[model samples]
Target chain A: MSVRHSMVKGMQNSVGYFISTFLFGIMFGVAAAASGLEQWQGLLMSGMVFSASAQFAALEFWQSPLPLGTIAMSVFLVSTRNILLGMSMTHHFDNHSTGRKILWLFILNDPGVVTAIRLDSGIDKLGYITGYGITLMLSWLISTWVGFNLSNIITIADFGAMDFAGPLMLGIMMVLFSKGSAASPIPWIISGIAALVLHEIGLPAYLILPISVATGIASAMTNRHRSHPPKGETRIKANNND
Target chain B: MTMTTIIMMAGIVYLTRVSGYFIGLQFRHIGELRPILEALPGCAMMAILIPAVRQGDIVDFTSLAVVLGMMWKTNNVVVSSVLGMAILLFGDNVISGS
Candidate 1:
């Protein structure tokens, strides 16, 4: 596809992804409000914090009046994977202007990183990243506000259903990640085991996240010999063929 | 929430999002971290998914059936989500007598 066509397609796909993801945030907001947060507080959490897992964790601990330090640590541990995402996409910004680069960096979320990796045309990397990020951010922000404002409209009976949104989204992510990969199930199995063991041991809920991440990372590193991409010209040709 | 609280929360959130971009750039020269970083998404997904799968309050046979069905039948996200929601609703009504 031409650069313009690619950019337009990227924007179109981004809009669809954003709308779906935004609905998830709205569901989260409704759940949080049901859990005791005020409508505006839920909105602010979705808008500012943006990490669903951490926000849900904070909501769970809200009644306890946990220390800010503890909350910060939970959020940091949950979000540490983004550092790797940012590193992976750094090459795409190598030729972009500094301002554009900074904006791209701000919006780099899971979907953004996945979409960036899928792009074949390098010339429109900035446009694709910008379009994807802005779409996702706006959707999340708007849906969160809507959920907060409409929390009362949703029944408490219905709120529990909204709690399922997090898992549902994660399930969808699993499906997305499984495409074109034979070894995809290995990390998933490891994670399931880690989660089961942690829960069995009665580990603090917040700590399970980091433990799962650590387990998966360690497993992936150990199995790197099985899936390492060939280097240099051979790798480039292989990628291009795909 | 108070304005101070909002500011604090916002600062923390922004720091998480932006720190990767800024700090990751500096570490590019290290070279060794790239392969490790490439595997991070799988790690993160596992982190989010594992505890979710094991939640005592939530997980049940019906949900497991739903997960398996979704993973096996279509693996299409939209379809799987619908299947999951349907199964959860059915399970809830049957289990809770609601």
Candidate 2:
């Protein structure tokens, strides 16, 4: 594709991602509100934390008065994917200035990582990453505030019904993640079994996040030497050059 | 917690987030840890979903129905969520009536 065409396609993709991400943000806001966080606090969490899982976990831990170490550990375990995401983009970003790389690292969430992996050229990586991050950040900030404010207007019963929005959004995210994967079911099965066993053993509900991560990592590590390319493989010859 | 306490808690949360960036950059070169890091989110989702499916203080027939509906309607998140809530409400009413 020509530079112009690629730019346009990138723009179109960014816009579509922004819209879906915004809806997901609204869902986050609703969930946060239902969880009893005040309006401004929810907005602040979205703006500052910028992570759905961490934010939700923090909210749950809020009432517990858990030690900082415990909270940090949970957040660390949940947000560990950012590390893998950072690795995948490192080759593409090797040539960029240190400041740009730092900024990218700061904003590297799942969507940003996914967008980076899908790019056809390394030249567009920074642009797409920036676009995805900025759009996601704005949507999260605004929708969180909206949900917080909306919480007061809606009854608990309504909020209970709407609470499904967050999980449903995540389920959609998983579907998006699983596209084109012939062996996707394997990881899902392994993770599901691990989760069941852990829950039966009396692990906390939030621990599921880390357990799933362990399961996926174990599965991936065990199969790493396989012949197939890992899932979400993008073709960026420029990346190799960088 | 008091308003002042909540505000302080929020500040701590912000610090943790900023800390993640620095931590990520520091450990960026550690490629050996990549697979486990990548798989954590999926593992977490499964962990949460398993208990969510069973009958208990939080899980029940209603929750299971919701999860099943979500799995079945993989594309329509809104519909699945609504169906799940409907089942929960119906289940709640039936148990109370009984």
Candidate 3:
């Protein structure tokens, strides 16, 4: 598929999770309002921070005396997984300028990264990632506005099911990512087991992604002798996606 | 104080989001590490998803199965997510006996 075609597919994938994320943003907006942020402040923060876990954690520290150090640390700790997520995309951004790739990091989110990694091996489809990221960001901001204005519609179903949307989105996208006989499942299994065990053992949340990604990469490297990438997997020209 | 806190928080989060890519680009000489890089998308993906799945109740497990089954049958991303959510919301409520 052409890079443009891939980009369109990615946007469609983002839209698939749009409702869940929008509801999630609305929930965050309601939380922000309850935490003493004004509607504009909530929208502004959502746009800039662009992280659900960080924003939600910040709400817990929304006292008259804001604990800047503690609040920033919590945010940092929560989002540190993005480090691994961004690293995984580095190969996709190889041909782009370093500055451009770094700038692209601004739009990185769970959904965006999942779609962005689907960029064909030889192609630099930065536009695909940007399109996916922007769609999610706008949905988040717009739904924040809705939730801020209509917090009364909080409803009966907003408690737990709303939260599963994130994971469900992840699960659905994983299905998309793993769909084929060509890819090996062993690395995925290893990474998942390692990460889950580490998490259950109470490892710091920030450490999970890096360690798990490292584990998967290590296993894949060791297994490369067993199953190599089919030929033409090298850095081919962008024109030969087929 | 609030504005300062917001900016600081966003800055910290943004740093994590970009740090790995930053390090990767800074030293592109590590051609030997390409397999590790190739392994990352799947590893990182499962790493992110597994914890949530493990923490979930039966509703989540069922919904996951529904999504996977739908994907297997239809090969559609958008519809699978929507249908998954619908099943999750329906199943969650039904399981709760509400």
Candidate 4:
């Protein structure tokens, strides 16, 4: 398919996310304004960071004179997942030009990357991701601005269970990422168990992602080895037995 | 927040965004790690999701199940999500209210 075609398709796919993102952005703007940010400051934050989760978390720690250390740590921790996300996209971005890579990565948010990977194969991955990113960024920035302006009128409580949207998207993403393969469920089960155990045992919240992912990776690796029968006669026997 | 703080936060997030790609690039040629790379995204999703779901009440659980079932059946993220959210809103407002 042509790059333009893929880009337009990407934008179309992103329309699904735009609504939730726009709502969330308005909510963020209200929260940011209530939290003592000027209109420009909130806009700047939305524009520069472009991460709703991290921006929300940072707002929780927003204070006068700037608790730099606390806010920085919270932002970093909330953003840690993006690193893995970026890593996952390496295959898609590997062939693009350096400038393209930078521009694409600049707008790389969760919804965009998830959509890029979830969509059908054969389209121009670069164009698709760029389109998805641009759409989401625009939705976020515009909604945040709107929310900021309407802060005094609509309170955060005006939205009910809106936070659930993030988790819902994540859950959808999990299904999308694991739909085809037989053994794919194994890693998710492992990751879930690890996350629960770590959280229950009082591991720092930030540590959960890395540790659980490692366990999942280990399980996948082990499962891969087990599924592939070892050596000669056993392998043939295993295949025939199947 | 000041420009400096905003810059710092942006810088930190931007680093997270790009570092993973660069890091993955390092291991890109490693034939052995390909499976791990492939599994990373799903695992990461579960790692974040499981705890949140665990902490949630019945409404959250039901909605999650609905979301998963719909996605499994249809493979349409948008529809599954909207249905999930609808269930969530319904459960929270209607069932719980009644």
- Best by the TM-score measure: 1
Error of 4 at A59 (Å): 9.7
Write candidate 4's Cα lDDT for B1-98 as tens digits: 47888899999989889887888888765446656756765676677677778777788788899989988998876577667766765676666578
lDDT of 4 at A178: 71
The regions of model 4 sitting more than 4 angstroms off are A1-46, A49-105, A108-132, A143-160, A180-183, A228-242, B1-28, B86-90, B93-97
Q: State which candidate, 1 or 2, has the greater DockQ.
A: 1
TM-score of chain A of each: 0.68, 0.69, 0.61, 0.65
Go through the candidates in order and give each one's C-alpha lDDT: 0.61, 0.57, 0.70, 0.74
Which regions of candidate 2 are displaced past 4 Å?
A1-12, A57-62, A67-70, A116-122, A156-176, A179-191, A201-242, B1-34, B52-74, B82-98
Tens digits of per-residue lDDT for model 2 on A70-180?
355545654655555555665565555777665555555666657658666634665566656666777778877776666565554445644444444444444544552
TM-score of chain B of each: 0.52, 0.54, 0.61, 0.68
Tens digits of per-residue lDDT, candidate 3, A33-56, equal 656688988988999998776676
Please state the error at residue B83 of candidate 2 in Å: 4.3
Across A142-216, the per-residue lDDT of candidate 4 in tens digits comes to: 999997777555443333454455566567656755764344678778987999999899875567767987898
C-alpha lDDT of residue A225 in model 4: 80
Task: Write down the worst ten-residue block by lDDT for model 4 chain A.
Answer: A154-163
Worst 10 residues of 3 chain B by lDDT: B30-39
CAPRI verdict on model 1?
acceptable
The full ranking of all candidates by TM-score, starting with the best, is 1, 2, 4, 3
* Candidate 1 ranges with C-alpha deviation above 4 Å: A1-13, A51-63, A67-74, A94-100, A110-124, A149-153, A156-164, A178-188, A225-242, B1-35, B38-61, B64-68, B86-90, B96-98
Q: What is the DockQ of each candidate?
A: 0.38, 0.31, 0.41, 0.41
